[model samples]
Target: MSNKIKLTVLGLLITLNSLKAQQTSNKSYDVCIYGATSAGVVAAYTAAKYGKSVLLIEPGKHVGGMSSGGLGLTDIGNKYAISGIALDFYRRVGQHYGQFEQWIFEPHVAEDIFHTYLEKAKVPVLYQHRITAVKKQGNVITEILLESTGPRSVGRVKAKMFIDCSYEGDVMARAGVSYVVGREANTAYGETFNGVQLTNGHQLPDGIDPYKVKGDAKSGLLWGITKGQLAEKGSGDNKVQAYNFRICLSNDPKNRIPITKPAHYQPERYELLIRQMEKRTWKSLQDVFIWSRMPNQKTDINNRNGFSTDMIGMNWDYPDADYRKRQEIWSAHTDYTKGLLYFVGHDPRIPEHIRAEMNEWGYPKDEYMDNENWTHQLYVREARRMKGALVMTQHHCEGREMVQDGIGMAAYTMDSHNCERLVVNGMVKNEGNVEEGGFGPYPIAYRAITPKETEAANLLVPVCLSATHIAYGSIRMEPVFMVLGQSAALAAVKAIDGKSAVQEVDVAALQRQLKENPLADGSAPDVLIDNSDSFRVKVSGKWSVQKRGGYGPDYFLSDGHTDSSSFIRYYPDPNIKGRYEIYTYYAKLPERKAVTAVKVFDGKRLQEVVIKDEEVKVVGQTSGEWVKLGDYIFSGNGKPYVEITGNGEKVAADAVLLVAASK
Candidate 1:
């Protein structure tokens, strides 16, 4: 049958099935989610768990956006920031590997986990439903119209609340919610790394010629170099960070598809890479790409260095482009990436050692089996950021500004890929490559995810929350997106119960629910006392707070080389006096820095325990784990405490967990 006729038949079949399934024709739900991404699925699951009817609509066939797409080597800066459903997701993935949590995983494993969530939520997903328009009535989203794939089934989905979990904030934009694309000027948000940045000297090592012909300006620039004048430092413009495919390649020959010359391949397109390789002798093909190892001998290939996988300056029009134009951009990116890979592995002019190493990797035959074994989701690093109630800025990221109503925490560095490659001082340079990271995990405000009270009060945007360009870069990790997704869903439920708009929902109630019923179930969350919880963790002597690789927000590092007085004490503060299972977190410690003395006070006596490095094990990508510190009783007074005393060796303090002896 013709494609159009097939769609027509499919639509008729759907209508007939709906009529049979129920007598009344109903197209309404309590919650309407417009993306089946990692965030989208989590949001739908959360809404359904709250006893609300949820309709999850995906623009494509896949469910778990980039998390299951291929960015399997998670970009998590700190595990302590992850909470509730997001933490549960990692634990579920970990169970597959016979562990507690797994960050680096195969693409198929992540997708299977998402499918389990959908099945548990009892939410029916409408696949290939592209947003055509959003209908709103007086600042409230009444319904959204979508055109499904195969056939033009443009239909309306009415909902009490809407959550835009899509990477591109199409629903938010269509609902008249304000949003902005591209980097903001430093002055706009008072950020240090907001605008046109050239901090990293010409991306290509000095003397890499930009012209088509060596040293001939009249010959014109080669591929990938955009023709433009470099913008002044910290100035704003309509430029977005480069996007690429976080390809998953496998080395197992039995399950690998050989790297072949893809259609529309152009060898000359990678002339810059050839020139870059020539400037500095590369040891292996691995050095050219940010190839992080995954389970089952697979790899998550990311853009790294100059002239790698990131198709620079190619996706600037994506955030505002229509569906067809976006597809064209996606196809161009795919062609460029495929052509680059084929050229690197097959080009005889390249080093034999590099080609040999690259030959060992190819598309995994077991993954994306439905789509020619290739992932369909593009690694859209950043796109449209909703200009919501509060715009997160550098001040918040650096811990200089704190959010009183935080819904989630983001700890990754303020990172951005090269926004646009440029010709600078006669050498090809990359701009907007900023990787500033030093501050600890900062809370993402609830206001950051909600639409402004003036526009679409019922809509919540979690993936594309309110933030400046630099702030979004830090907050734009898959795990963090999942965190915000759960929080957004809870806020939606609370708004429905209160008969209020999303912005007017009680922030305190939402925060309390996030803590008391973290997983959206009545089950209680463990009482946590992280080092970042300054009010609960008391410290003495000199303690250095280090970011990254900690259990919670950040960890404390200190040594008694000068004085043995340094100590970090945690107060569990169990609401009632009772026996609780205690555990202390251990971050990846420095060499010869493992031994530490821990003391727990049970209101009667002080019990001491010594920690050994080899005793604790690592799980997933996080370099930290929780070790039991024994159960103890608190007196209901402030007498009970857990302290890691700084001894002769280096001491590290992360977090303390108090679990009620009962489940």
Candidate 2:
């Protein structure tokens, strides 16, 4: 009886006892959160902390969705923008590491933190309960029916507020809320990056054949290759972005479990990858496998390059698939990933050096012990996004528009993994990988997370909120999900207290509670200047506003071109003059220049500070949060201006903030 197994059994026992008790009582809770994801956990905790009785239901045996499943290396765009319960989770994670806060951590550590949150908040969580049906009266949900495997076979939870925090938006869809699956045409939302991106994206190596027989059109296409005429760029389609498992691996022999071929493994499935390897000379395993280090010796392994981990074009049926069908898809992805590991380590065609290096790394024995040393959750990148009153489009991400009723911020790039694999002009290519960044942080509108009042007034959706496929790409990060989850719970609590619909809650009141700050004069801090603000653009190239998920919106993107010089200048108010801390918000992209030159004219001298692209610490109070450049004295005269010039590298002049150091 290992301690891990004992603890898991005890937790299950507690959950069963709680479920049995609840079923008998038939007590209606103030809030009911489904999914048990990082968002769900935080939402449950937030609701409980605010004096609302919360019921956290999870379909799986484990919690924390991807964060604790195997994604140990957190994908936080700008750590500063994360606040409230989400930030508290990270701070607690840091405490476990004996530091103030830490982003990258071990999977078990994250799970422990989630458990601690549940215990401290006294939130009762029922595990392995799938939502069978939702009972509703008009637009308000009355109760949710739950089905379980063991002792407690069936249960129902009545709650005033229901939050669909599942990654798949299962409850949202089952409840008859209007939602969408697959990509939308670029024209649908006046977006440039939405829809069927067949060209100018993540493509396979040149000269690869898509047919089983070379130069023969009659010969059927190879396995995993879709057969069809490529759709026009930006055209709408039913295709979805790829999904993969964030497998946790380890090189330490003490904890390593060798990768084995899956039971349903078919060598022909990965024929494209073998062909790719044949054409290119291998450098190292790192060229194909992306291994990011966790706190322990374990690694968060992910797909890299064109032919990597993402199972492209295989998840198109996942969004609308039933539970049984979804399980099949999950199994397929697991087999593909496990088989890839085994093939890379043992295949004869692979280079000796690459094979040897891959063979050294294997699954961690201590992690995900019950799931055969593999993550139980599949990384469902994009699924059923709700079509609510407000839709977060690329325009919102590009800073062309801003949501006034903001619940949280998202700063990650508008990233979408490959969606389809096809043959283009005699070459096999992977399509739909949009990695556009340069926009700063942008606010996720409260309306986006809420369903239309006519659809469902009592239900709040955080994980599968309203957004286009491209915008959802940026909003899909785990941290941002947690942030939105907290906000959604807050909104649910407010609605329950006010006896109002989720959409009818005062936006300003919610913002005040979220900000959690008040001045001596009983006024909230003037958080000024988001990406939606108008700015003066000057240069040969055009400056566009872009939105980073988790962070607010940013302005001034050069579109990855260095030859075209551009400058974005901002003038502060004439009456506001003092020693102020200047912060520049931009995407922390890998291709960003090491040093970006910015000139500040303080009505006396024009000073230049070389700002580092990697500095993402929140310095002072402002709406747009990012790295601080430095503090400088600004004359009361309206002439004080700051200018950002694009000189090589991908320049992102998103937003600038000047906070008065002294009033």
TM-score of each candidate? 0.90, 0.80
Clashing pairs in 1: 80-551, 80-552
lDDT of 1 by residue, 537-601 (tens): 89997778876667765688875463567788997664447778888888876553656689998
lDDT of 1 at 436: 91
What's the lDDT for candidate 1?
Answer: 0.85
Off by over 4 Å in 1: 1-25, 151-154, 532-549, 561-571, 574-582, 592-611, 615-623, 628-647, 659-663
lDDT of 2: 0.78
**Lowest summed lDDT over 10 consecutive residues: which window, candidate 2?**
517-526
Per-candidate count of clashing residue pairs (backbone under 3 Å): 2, 21
> What C-alpha lDDT, on a 0 to 100 scale, does residue 646 get in candidate 2?
72
For residue 150, model 1's alpha carbon misses the true position, in angstroms, by 3.4
